[model samples]
Target: MKKIKGIIDRFEEGFAVIEIQGGTKDCPKDIFPKDTQVGDVVYITGNQVEIDKSETKKLAKEIEDLMNEVWED
Candidate 1:
């Protein structure tokens, strides 16, 4: 069981493409939870996927900080 975190980038052909820290992947709609949408954070392990609110916040903060650094220089 490999666990990873990612944000739902978009959906195509009934598959949801999740953007992770270093890559992206397409998850079948059947395995995705209802009410999930773009920008939602998710935790994936094997065939199951679910939301991780804390990890979402953490990733958002990291992105914000990176953007801040780029503009501050």
Candidate 2:
């Protein structure tokens, strides 16, 4: 099956809220890495989810920066 691109909008009750090009879906949160978070882009096909490594790294850094900002003195 063709993989569809999506972004994680949120996670609730162990489900990942994915926002696709034209819609949204709730997938098993465990289908992704433990470090996955909202705004991380991913590719999905059936029950398989493949995260975009570059985008994930970007998001991770963005989150780290945001957290640092929150703790800045």
Candidate 3:
């Protein structure tokens, strides 16, 4: 099985837009966990999708730091 790491970019209609390596892919929302949200990190292995909470938090923190730095006077 091929394992891919991606981020939940957005949701449109009944599909979730996942940003993976190189580009993005549209996957059915039902394949993701019920509590999954935009910006959450995910791992896709074959037909199963799993959220990576720690990685999500880490990425969020990194982005927040960058934004803070950019906005600081």
- Each prediction's Cα lDDT score? 0.86, 0.86, 0.95
Model 1, 28: alpha-carbon shift in Å? 0.5
Model 2: worst 10 consecutive residues (lDDT sum): 30-39
Minimal lDDT window, size 10, model 1 = 51-60
Point out where model 3 deviates above 4 Å: none
lDDT of 1 by residue, 1-73 (tens): 8898889999999899999886988889778888877878998898899987777778788999999999995
For residues 1-73, write the lDDT of model 3, one tens digit per residue.
9899999999999999999886999999989999999999999998799999999999999999999999999
Q: lDDT per residue, candidate 2, 1-73, as tens digits? A: 9988888999999899999876889899888878776888899888788779898788779989999999999
Clashes of each: 0, 0, 0
C-alpha lDDT of residue 2 in model 2: 91
Q: In model 1, how large is the Cα lDDT of residue 30?
A: 76
CA shift of 12, model 2, Å: 0.7
Give candidate 1's whole-model lDDT: 0.86
Model 2 off-target regions past 4 Å?
A: 56-73
Best-performing candidate as measured by lDDT = 3
Q: Candidate 2 has what TM-score?
A: 0.67
Q: List the residue pairs that clash in candidate 3.
A: none
Better of 1 and 3 by TM-score: 3
User: Between the candidate structures 1 and 2, which one is better when assessed by TM-score?
Assistant: 1
Backbone clashes counted, model 1: 0
